[model samples]
Target: MPKSWPDQLLQMLLTLAVILSTALTIFIITLPSSYSHFQSGEITEEDFTEDDRQHAGRSGYSYYHNHRDTDGKLKTECTIQIVVLGDIGRSPRMQYHALSVASHGGRVDLIGYVESEVHPDVQRSRFISVVPIKPHPKQLQASNRLLFLLVAPLKVLWQVFSLYYALGYQTKASKWMLVQNPPSIPTMAVAQFVCFFRNTRLVIDWHNFGYSILAMRLGSRHPLVTLAKWYEGLFSQDATAHFAVTNAMARVLKKEWAVEALALHDRPPNHFQPLTSIQRSTFLASLPDTAKYAANIEDGSWRLIVSSTSWTADEDFALLLDALVDYSARAAENERIPKILAIITGKGPLKQYYLNHIQHSKENGKLPNVDITTAWLSAADYASLLGSADLGISLHTSSSGVDLPMKVVDMFGTGLPVVGWSKFEAWTELVQEGKNGCGFDSAEGLTQLLQDLFGDDGQRLKILRQGALEECNRRWDDEWMPVAGQLFQLKP
Candidate 1:
């Protein structure tokens, strides 16, 4: 079968051509496919309402007219159907949103979980309904960290189904959804699916990215945190409009998730009203040690500085202690006879540790000029006590740049100007140096600032106090109304 040289060479070339064609075909078949950044989370145009194309500005939550009269004319209903999901009884922030909607006569189904029940007095509503849910047992057990992470999303998904049943998916009016994020697990993606299916609008209120929070609990390198960070960023893009706590977080929303975000400032609760002398005295009398402080208010011998905290690792509480000691030493060196008592409020895991340290300092006579005491007060009592303070000390720096501690807002509500311990960007936004309050980088610097404020008969301190009062005049309802109307397309 030995052929001529020309024929055999031609056949070999033909075989080589066939092999290359097959290889090229295989390569083309295995190539990665392009993804559409249409922000649809796997849903199609058919999933959306017919009017979605006409009203893309409506927080991406527009729907076609489904309501018809007896003559077949389309009816536009005034009902703003909304679903708010969070642990409202426990979280003051969530309570603010739910109460606002309910108080305004919006149809809201407020869904959350609680161990017991919040008293009916506090949970009263006509249009807003409460949907209590039970979290999976594993969600509470942190000993099995990996197991907890594995079950959390499943548990949340089950909760979403519970929400569907609770709402009954029976309405046809244009809808809106507001969900709090900490887990950030099923919130955005599941909301997208629900909104598409039910013909509603979606709004995500970003307190902080849940992954950044998880990074604080478990190191940033943990597999779950890494996955959460990636997936959350990916899915969060599906929302119509995002409301972030700070401008820095708003930038994060736009850059990381390509989301349209507006920075919504948190205002102080409206319940913190100015108290008259008699009312103030009655409130102070209810507290245990506050009466002694109240009696000496006329003397001007002792200055009361109040500091509130959740006592988490994010706060550098040691700085406050050091500053107190340093100020006392400086005052004694000058023979000024310093008298300062710090009212540290709130409790957390680190409370015992700091309490012991303060006790040791007292017993050892390490700090002579400054005294410290703890108070755990009710909401009304707490605000009243803050109003009585000469100054406020804030040690909260966000673990992430996104969150501004509510403690700062609470202090400002009482007209108590504060010295912020950390230099986070949000602090700079809220605090005007030497104006409403000042900021310091170190313990010594803060100690010096304290001396400057409390000295000279506290002339500068009074100015700062007035500034705090004037600057934070906007209450939660005032700030929330316009923003709510803008988002939901309604008048305040």
Candidate 2:
């Protein structure tokens, strides 16, 4: 089959992009002094002298920071830049990283798009300064599908320029640049160039494989998907260090990608603690939409189940809908089955789609005993909702199958036991079956689990609740300090 002119032109452009990217990578790698010194591991926190400290103080930024105490012990104070391709506010793990750095007397330039309002603590922090990146314009709609080949490159070019400008001009030069992956396209490439020019180290925090995510929309065999994989592997290899969410992901990175990554598990912050009965009651009463549900919950007539989603492709909301329908049918048959107030929070593109489906189900009288509500909550309110809930549900089937869901981590933090999808390998890392939470592979499995958990004599539920409560002790600061803190030369 002979290809069209547009297709031929697109292929040529992609080939050129690959060549240019390869050339830039090679150029960065061959920077003799910078490359050798960066790889040497000679420059460290302990190696910083009094003269170096004085020079760093004068310059306002340094690769190695050491402050002498009254007793003459050297204290570490690192300067770092944390980069996110998505919204800065929505990226909880990266926010935690920034917060951790701030707490340790390290200065951080948090760079990303300013979309939703950030966590209150992050906003209030003096040590953490946000560097906003102007997002690319959405000129072409999804209907212009074929034109995406043209639009996509422009978008990437815009992002590259935006990111480079943000790192180069907007933010202060730092010792280390920690960037989130799964958004591994122009970000890694731009960070690499910035590192090359500035002589700074680059650290990639792997949330998941970006290519696997693209493959969700474009399929595995797609040329773009294959290029993305190659691009990711190439750029990622040159990073100073890597952080993965799960041990499985770390192992995969080492075995498959040949990149050794530290498994820095995501833990909930201190604010995500379990709420008291009084606190839950007050918080629920404050919500206008959930007022009716609140009354039922307070009176012990309805069980509150909390679940959140970005309304993305990896999660199957249809499975949740099917489960709710099955639950409603079972509740009709048995009087022991309690009524449910299911709250699914967070905003995304497919949210309205699911809302429509849920509305249709309600109109059809399919979910008589189950009430589904979608919300976009503030950080505090969202934490309160999790604390108030009787149980949590996770629909995230990871795109890479190796990464764990942060929603489940948040759920565990609030002392709410979860019912997560059992299909993925990373599920075992966070969701401990029959301990803190249960796992289900299908809608039927979810229905049966919900029936058993909620419809029971309250013993099993009590046990899981206790296990969840125990998880509250494992907060983010404690977990982050040793791994991320040490890696970045920030001392608590």
RMSD (Cα, Å) for all candidates, in order, is: 12.3, 7.9
lDDT by candidate, in order shown: 0.67, 0.84
Alpha-carbon shift of residue 40 in model 2 (angstroms): 21
How many clashing pairs per prediction, in order? 0, 0
Q: Mind giving the per-residue lDDT tens digits that candidate 2 earns over 1-492?
A: 999999999999999999999998976674323322332222234544465456553222242334434554433346788999999888999998987886666778899999998887776654568889998887833424478666788888889989988888787567788999969889999999888777789999999999999888878999999999999999998899999999999999998779999999999988898998999888888886567778888875688998899898899999999999999999999988999989998878789889999999999999989899888889988999999999999999988999998998898898999998979888888877898999999999999999899898878988899989887779898888889988987656
Instruction: Using TM-score, give the best candidate's number.
Output: 2
Q: What lDDT score goes with residue 208 in model 1? A: 77
Measured with C-alpha atoms, the lDDT of residue 174 in candidate 2 is 74
Give the lDDT of residue 30 in candidate 2: 49
Deviation in angstroms for 441 in model 1? Answer: 2.3
Of candidate 2, the 10-residue stretch with the lowest lDDT total is 34-43
Residues 106-128, model 1: lDDT tens digits: 44556666533442323444334
